[model samples]
Target: MTAIRANSLRNGPDEQGRFGIYGGRFVAETLMPLILDLEKAYRAAQVDPAFQAQVKDLGEHYTGRPSPLYFAERLTAQLGGARVYFKREELNHTGSHKLNNCIGQILLAQRMGKTRIIAETGAGQHGVATATVCARFGLPCTIFMGATDVKRQWPNVLRMKMLGAEVRPVTSGAGTLKDAMNEALRDWVTNVETTYYLIGTAAGPHPYPEMVRNFQSVIGEEIKAQFFEAEGKLPDAVVACVGGGSNAIGTFHAFLDDPSVRLYGAEAGGHGIDVENGHAASMTGGRPGVLHGNRTYLLQDADGQILEGHSISAGLDYPGVGPEHSYLHDTKRVTYVPITDNEALEAFQLCTKLEGIIPALESAHGLAEVIKLAPTMKKDETIVLCLSGRGDKDVESVGRYLGLIE
Candidate 1:
């Protein structure tokens, strides 16, 4: 296995600000000026000691950085192949990994003197995270979500509202995450002078993909240290679920140079083999296209209209994967797989039953992959899965599906 070295992020930007043809500021003329301003401010902030300290302090005190790399002994015993390790991001503020990027973007927005923040959410984790950061920083926040998601994830919608953010429902297209992103882009277009679009995923225009990944790389950094201490070396494999693939990228970044560590990104296999039946396996079924910002792996039609992605877990129901993931796939540095909704549900139930842990639906995709891979591997190997979010938001949907919704 050839290890994918993460050399680009450690270096300065190339002429076009790309991470080896994976990142570029592909945007409309209307947003170019504002995006350029953000790029300039972000560059300045990267060198500012005060800004660095502020972000670091907030990460420690607010978002609970350095989340534990806990060994799942019970899970390991049950699986009986590789030792199971979990990068517990579910314990972070807002109960998801989304807050890490949100905090950094909010601080950058503050440095740039932007007074308003806007975001899009599907499962509402990202929306809640952006709203939480805005509330902490005393900035006005607006979150756009699909009308369906707004209703399905009402608890998070309520959390965002309570945090003083205006939650707007997007009724366009399929009325989901993609539509929410479209609405957010429109809002940014209209309010470009005073608002900063805090994109939640790592798939957006040039700087966002790079910026968000940098903020999240802390996950891999911590995991690397912990894995060394625990196993006297690196893990044999690393895995995470992919929406726009921020969490997976973060977890995989540290292992890129390890050569022996196999990286896996589990895509949502919705309700089957047929993409229409159940799947959001962007890498498995998508083509290159432009959507919110950059050209990447997108589930689109012949006319280039984005398709509606489906998943039992709302967070994984995005129509695109990050550009970097597309690059990784092309380079054969990482393996991308699909976990069906049934497999995820089984893994979710199994983890809860075996270890008394209820993982987020998004994370369950990674767990589902473990259920598949573990049984076939030798008992000496190790697999570390990034549990990107907690499962509280999914209780209602799971309950309704199981006929337990009161």
Candidate 2:
């Protein structure tokens, strides 16, 4: 077995603030001042024991940290050869793992004296989660999303509005998550003073990937502790869907040194393999390029025009991924694969029917991979899957895809 150091996994930006050729503050001159201020505040608050306590308290009392590690008895029996366990992040506040990070960021925003919060969301889980925290803290909130996402994820859009956030829809480009993110960046550049950009994923600039990862490490921390208490041994594998890679990173962090524990990140395979304009398998089909301030694997053309990525799950339809994921893929520490749309849809229905659990479309990608892999594994081998979010946001889209809706 290859011995690995846990400390080595804890990495940040270079002196110039880049994460393995990805991540850096890229904002207009106006926002640069605010970015620097945020960096200083976040760095300080990060080390402050009192601030950490506050974040921890919220995680326990409010957002419900240590979400259950449930043995998937039915799923295991169905697979017949392997045991499956689910880290029930779907039980967390707002019905997703997103709030785990939002709560931490909002607390940091408050500590930093930022008055408003801004975020870009695709499936709206992150938007709704951020709005929920904003309401909890009495902070103003704004969420930018693609017009298409707003229509497809209307329930969550309504939830955000009900939570007192202004949900703006961006109609440019493909009018999807990427365009929405670009619009949010523009908003940040213009309103950096009174607003704190509460990024939902680990794909953004420095401090964001590091900050969101720290916020999300709760998943790994809990799974490890719970595995010990439940099985007296570690899980044989950890699996998660990677959009911007936050959830995968969260689930994989603690297991990095456990050489026998495999890690899998499932990217959206949209329709199929990388036919031009078809898939969101960025890790599989993309090349390193700069998009939205970070140098990471991006689906772009030769001239650097970012191409629109397709996915059955809006959340997973991204052009680029977090740099750490890029690093892990390159180092072969983690295995990255793509799950096709039909496969994910089948998994979505199977989980709903078999386990009585309706997972978010984004999370269905991971489940689909599990469906393919579990039957072939050893009966005693355990796999822990990060159920990243609930499926409410995707019901309409799925209905439409199934021709149940006009």
Candidate 3:
């Protein structure tokens, strides 16, 4: 890996919230005023020292910042290639990296005098995280989940309910994440005065993609410092799973200007990429289109209607990805790979057996890519993988898949 001068990759979305031409406010006219207001408020909050201080304090004491970067000796040895490290975001409170952005947004909601919170979730990690924050703040929370997701990720559904959030099951459009997002948007439009729409990913209109990435960038910031302290330099490569791409973007942002460090995003390949409607490799299989308030690569047909995506990991089953990822794809800054369900499952079991870590199915996609890339690199080189969430919520699903449960 060769070093290069630092670049301005961080100054993204420009003034109109676009990463090149990939992102913009493509919402209904009724929602335009709210989006503009949010952009203004977010820009103000970015420079507010008091607001920054509060978020910092909560990150340290409440959500647990600086998640460890642990060297995976056993797994690295098994792969027999580059040294491997895990950024353990699964250890954060509420059990995933989703809380990082949720906490920041919740604080912003409070500052704006919002009284109600609404969010959409696919795998339930974000929903649970949002519900947890709302419970802590004593605010009413309503979570919209696709009916399919509610059934598949029932554990998280139960967790959200237990946290006092009203779980509304959306039955429209295949009953998945995209549908839930649509329902959340409608709810926000009707209740804009008192409701805050907390999006779970680094996708969505305007300030959302920018703001979520900013909040989640803490992962990359901590990684830069920790890797320097541990290995005395930057990593050779960084890898993470990309659904709507928040965790991957968070882990990749700090290293973007480091030309020597390669980046990889592993998308869920449910069965195989060749099987029709069988995977969620949006960048690989789809084309640019507008959906869910932004223009980006989408899985659509000849008539341009969005198609339902498939992935063993519910989180990655989406038809589109984050706009920044789209920009990165166009510029060749990152390599996006498709890892199939069988591949991810094998990696999941291997990580559990070798490292004693039960990774979420989504994180297993990253591990699968690491397994593929590590064996080709020199032993001295290093790869850092983001362990995005714990597998506790996935154990039952895995058991069912493996026929260990009735």
Candidate 4:
């Protein structure tokens, strides 16, 4: 919908993979060779028509991409302000946008002759997506998940196992997403030759943030064309939830050069922003620090040690955000807002009742922001909210929250 740019949004991270002062390769020496190799492979893949054709074919048939951009007629009428559209990524295969990146990375892994696939997951969506791809390719797969996430996202854990991927629970450091990532990295270091570390989000070392963003950018690209076809104009604001920031970055990438299109990212404000250890709103409540291989805004203590992040949405309960988000925040290219667990829950139910769409809790954070922003805008203005995942994996958690289940 926004006026197209002559060049695609690809001039980020520079040659050294630094998005301003935020992103860079900050991993250990042992992983440097593998990282460099991955960079080379990715660059080659970028220019190879055969690689592009393979990825595109899989995206169309396997992942069911070009997900719809649907106008939320009921929600728009109820809000009585701006028109709201839902970018239905939740409708994609594996029940989330995670599959898009997984499909791309798996193709790269195959091309690189990697025999094993390893990944880390928070809410289990990424793990399930990775496992699904591995199953399709008949490649051995292993997933590292935080002990806490293993308990909370049991459905996804079961899904991963059913897909024939081994799930390893990580117990270090709060036993959450960050710990799972640490364990995954250690595994990559140990088996770099045989294994391809399939990172879930748009974070990690050089190439990863860039690679994931490029894969996930399909969401924004589709939205741009679909919205233009439907409404003849770009939405005034685009919104998505930020954890490791894949979905947010993807949804915002195509519109970066469109000055009139504002971008909003909703972060997890667990209990309340004021409460210590209560939220995962990294950009809003945290300072920049190094974590998980890149320098980014992180929830940390006075000694610079990382702190545990809290959130009802397992996917969003991370201490640090992707480095590109840090750069965007620093430059005020995107406005970051915090949405509490209660607010997200309320919005989750509201969307379900109004539109018959049950969004993942991670996505509900964005819905929460949409609820806040929609009422303040003029009726002619529009907002496009990225519904990043479905809520089937989270039904049990929601039932427990509502005291409808034990």
Per-residue lDDT tens digits for candidate 3, residues 62-131, read 9998799999999999999999999999999999999999999999998888899999999999999999
**Winner by lDDT:** 4
Summed backbone clashes in each candidate are 0, 0, 0, 0
Candidate 4 or 1, higher lDDT? 4
| Tens-place lDDT digits, model 1, residues 51-85 | 88988898899988889988888888988898888
Instruction: Judge candidate 4 against the unseen true structure and give its global Cα lDDT, from 0 to 1.
Output: 0.94
All models: lDDT? Answer: 0.86, 0.87, 0.93, 0.94
Cand. 1 TM to true fold? 0.95
Over 161-188, each residue of candidate 4 has an lDDT whose tens digit, in order, gives 9999999999998899999999999999
Better by lDDT, candidate 3 or 1: 3
Off by over 4 Å in 3: 1-7
Full-model lDDT, candidate 2: 0.87
| Winner of 2 and 4 under lDDT | 4
**Compared to the true structure, candidate 2 yields what TM-score?**
0.96
Give me the overall lDDT of model 3: 0.93
- In order of lDDT, best first, we have 4, 3, 2, 1
Off by over 4 Å in 2: 1-7, 12-15
